[model samples]
Target: LEPLWLVGHTFAENTVGRLMERPPAVFATGASVGSVIEALREIVKQRMVTYVFVIEPAGRLVGVVAFRELVFADPNQTLDQIMLREPFSLRPQQPFVDAMREVVKRHYPVYPVCDDAGHLLGVVKGQTLFEQQAFEISAQAGSMVGVEKEERLATPWSRSFRFRHPWLLINLLTVFLAAAVVGFFESTINQLVVLATFLPVLAGQCGNLGAQSLAVTLRGMTLGELRGMSKLRLVGKEAWLGLLNGLVTGVVAGVGMYFASRGQTVADPVWLGAVTTAAMALCCALSGIAGATIPIVMRRMGADPATASGIFLSTITDISSMGVFLGLAALLLA
Candidate 1:
């Protein structure tokens, strides 16, 4: 007899179970070759079959045999003699993404679905799983910048505005905070005046660098590389990368600032250059740490690292870049 599920509930929506169809041919462990061939003739007309599954007397899945094996076998042979005892199969409860991952390298036309005890449930096509995965991944493209998970591509423009504006407004608040940092160093800005001109240049560069780090961290998480890796080690690696990159970029930005300052009417070009250089290096290094740390912290706090990480990192980069640039000027050049 078929599993009870096949008669009543069938497959569940948005799961591998839902994607599965009743196998074209399923047999008990004791089934004879002649019986399987007769069943195959009826099934082959309805669907293609590359393999046939063999199950135990108690309805537990036991093995599989290529369709060719059945045609060539002696009519008296039992399915047990011809079947490959250990066959790959999916569980009825597996999500589409995990199922797709499992079947990535498999080139089978069909696969059996089973329960925890290996009872044969149904069969699913490999192509259906791949199609669902592609659709799911493409739908999530907007998730990186704080888009709501429920938002769809065909969502009304009004709904899209509602979904988007909240984050934009939050970003505006962080921009104000960055402005407040510069406001704190007004005395330094007043003394040189030229320092005000380079503020955006400094902040924008660090923000871009921080965004790069955030992208890489999110990618690692998505690929499941962070699963068994040490969080501290990941943090340490980002910090070192930040420092080394800052040193190189800081030297270049310093040279450019030094030359740029020569054309300005500043009282102390060398001191101004030194301050900008020091601020660049300091802000960039901290921004890297911020980029790496924010996502990890979000993950630990049970928030999605991808959705909110950009917002946290933006706040860090803007505040750190401006704060360091102006604070260094106040301490050195003011």
Candidate 2:
């Protein structure tokens, strides 16, 4: 009789009988098929089994080699001698798409999950793995290679950002905004030629310092190793780091300006130095805050924190850096 034809209470009984025996009701195949039959009998002694499906060599699933078949065949005959060999067999480790194709073709209920070496590890049945993870991972596109996409999604969200695409878009937008900010400063840049010379050196150092703090914050969030108190501590550290970075970058830019424009005319550079220093410091501090907060905020909002984190961070750094620089210049230079 068909396993599905049973009614409610009997269905539970049949399922309980099938799943909880000394060993679960697993069908077996391959060279040691006879030994598997004995294993099933041992399970029957515990009132656990209703049947076993044994397969033949070459991994073809022969007819259902149930308890009755075992009883009739052999006090002594090896499974190879009595087992059916001409049967349906799926390649172990078949591509999931291919397995789905076969399922439609063959009308099979279960497909084995296996290693490339053809050793079976588990089974996929009735769209279970797909139903669980396909929505989240189908964006991965095309066939999964090596590790299964199902296994990949099983990892925590923080560690799974690399698999997603939103980060790349955010990065493009942020960088464009930063570039626009630099373009806005073109008039000031042309008037104060020395400032143009030092722009990169100033921004480069600030960018590095900002990036370092951002990286620390992101890693902490991703690892699930940060607590509320520790986050406050991180912010404090980044603040101090911003100040340190501002001092170093300012000094470098100021010294370079002092030397590069010794005979050239510009405004009182003491004023320029002060404002540049403050802007660098402010930008670094804000970058650190933006870096640390964006991911945490994303997580709180029930989104993937890491997915667009890098882009958001770049945007924060760019906008803040340009705004601070120009604001300070307008105040001190104009």
lDDT, each prediction: 0.78, 0.55
Give the alpha carbon lDDT tens digit for every residue of 1-334 in model 1. Answer: 5654452345565678878777767778788998889888988998888787888778888999887888789999999999989799998878776788788779577888888888888888877877776776554436656687668778999999999889888878888998898898888788777778888878887888888877778778766688889888877777777777777777777777777778756446777777777788778778888877877888898876777577778788888888888777777663
Instruction: Give RMSD to native, each candidate.
Output: 3.4, 14.3
TM-scores across all candidates? 0.81, 0.51
Q: What lDDT does model 2 reach?
A: 0.55
Candidate 1 global TM-score? 0.81
Output candidate 2 Cα RMSD: 14.3
